[model samples]
Target: MESYIQISKINDFIFCPRSVYLHTIYDNFHKKSYQRTPQIAGTIAHESIDTGAYSSRKRYLMGKEVYSDELSLCGKIDIYDLQTKTLIERKRKVVKIYDGYKYQLYAQMACMREMGFEIETLKIHSLSDNKSYILDMPNEEEWQKFIDIVERVNNFSVAEAKILADSKKCAQCIYQPLCHPL
Candidate 1:
């Protein structure tokens, strides 16, 4: 059977490899309904952006669903600037660029490229800071690293992928109870 991967899974693996294992291998886990203020805010922001409720003067595409058969990956891009050939991702916070975010963007970019879009730049619009970061696309080395991570996760057995229950992240994790039973 042909296996496919979601862009979110790439982020999850980067956040915690255990999350990928638990989410993919186990069917018992339940998603939490209660979202924190920040998460809620981000969701709202993304919805507005996705619905084209937030307008810009530039010619662009919003909320495009793209998939790459070559990479067997799929994701929706927040925005694609037609005139500038740039991709924009929105986030509620802008502390720093994480590997997960980078990989997510890379997957989106790869999908776009496979679809024959000319993507020249990558940008992240940080709602908290009201700042826009013009990011360089992942270089060859970073792309290789992402590919390696994907391959590792694809081959990971349930037992080999242990739960990494970090104190701070656990509080936000939906599968926390499963990982750390009281």
Candidate 2:
């Protein structure tokens, strides 16, 4: 059976498939999560977005939830400028454009387009830097890349996943403590 992927999780999935599995464990159990300052800050930064309080203008779909039946993916988009045909994905900070970020944006655009939204412009807005990176829409091949990720995630299982214990990537992960257990 295929997994019902979340557009927001495309970033986490690329960052580490195992982390996604661990995160699901937390969510399923409703465990108390110990978050660092950055994690709390990021959540605080998204308060408005989570509540859909972005713009008063009708041209923008602020904090709107979109679903893609084809991909079995769903997520709330930060901002969709209907007038400009732009979809903006906001982050707490962004010093560099990573593949994880790009894939998340691509997944969002693909799902939106499938839902009949005009999405010609792709963008990522960094709150810390107050800068936006405008990107071109993903092509068919790019969309296929995201599709491949979805398939991998569907096949991924906690028992079958490998834990990269000594990877430097773990240092940057919020779930490192739970994942590594000191």
Candidate 3:
């Protein structure tokens, strides 16, 4: 049976595979009282972007959900400009483009292409710096990389997944207590 994975899961795996195990297998998340400032800011930014109230630019389709059966991946795109064939992803802060960001966008691009949209460009709008960064569309090699990542995550056993935890990431993770107990 083909395993279905959320695009956000791909990002989580890239961020820290242990996160994937904790979220998908262990079924753990930070408690409701655990306030995440970055997450809260991101939510507000996404809401503004979704409503087309963040910028004065002409609005296109907003928060469109896309899926790819071939890859068994699904996600909601922040914006899609059909006229420019561009996909815009809003970020609360983008001090540096991380692999997780690329992987998430790659999954979205694959789903969009499978849905028959010609994607010419991928852009990340950093709300914090008020800057936009254009990302290169994934090529065949990049697509293969994404596929490999998916396969690795899907094939991991609970024990194998546990090895992906890193102390640095664990230090800042909200699920730290769940991952590491004193």
lDDT of 2 by residue, 1-182 (tens): 75477776777778888778777777665333656678879888888877766556788788778877787888888888988999888899999988888878777776788888878888999999899998766678977887898777666777755677667778888778778754
Could you tell me the TM-score of candidate 1? Answer: 0.83
TM-score of each: 0.83, 0.89, 0.83
Q: What is the lDDT of residue 58 in candidate 3?
A: 64
Please provide the root mean square deviation of candidate 3 (C-alpha atoms, Å). 3.0
Residue lDDT tens for model 1, 1-182: 67768777888787777777666655443333434456567778898777877776569788888988888888799899999999988888889988888778888998999999999998888988799988877788988998887777667666767756467887766555556652
The candidate with the higher TM-score, 2 or 3, is: 2
Alpha-carbon lDDT, every model: 0.78, 0.79, 0.77
| Regions of model 3 farther than 4 Å from truth | 1-3, 25-35, 49-59, 163-165
Winning candidate number (lDDT) = 2
How do these models rank on lDDT, best leading? Answer: 2, 1, 3
**Per-residue accuracy of model 3 over 10-46 as CA lDDT, tens digit each:** 8778777777777674444443434356666677778
**lDDT computed for candidate 2:** 0.79
- Deviating ranges (above 4 Å) for candidate 2: 1-3, 28-32
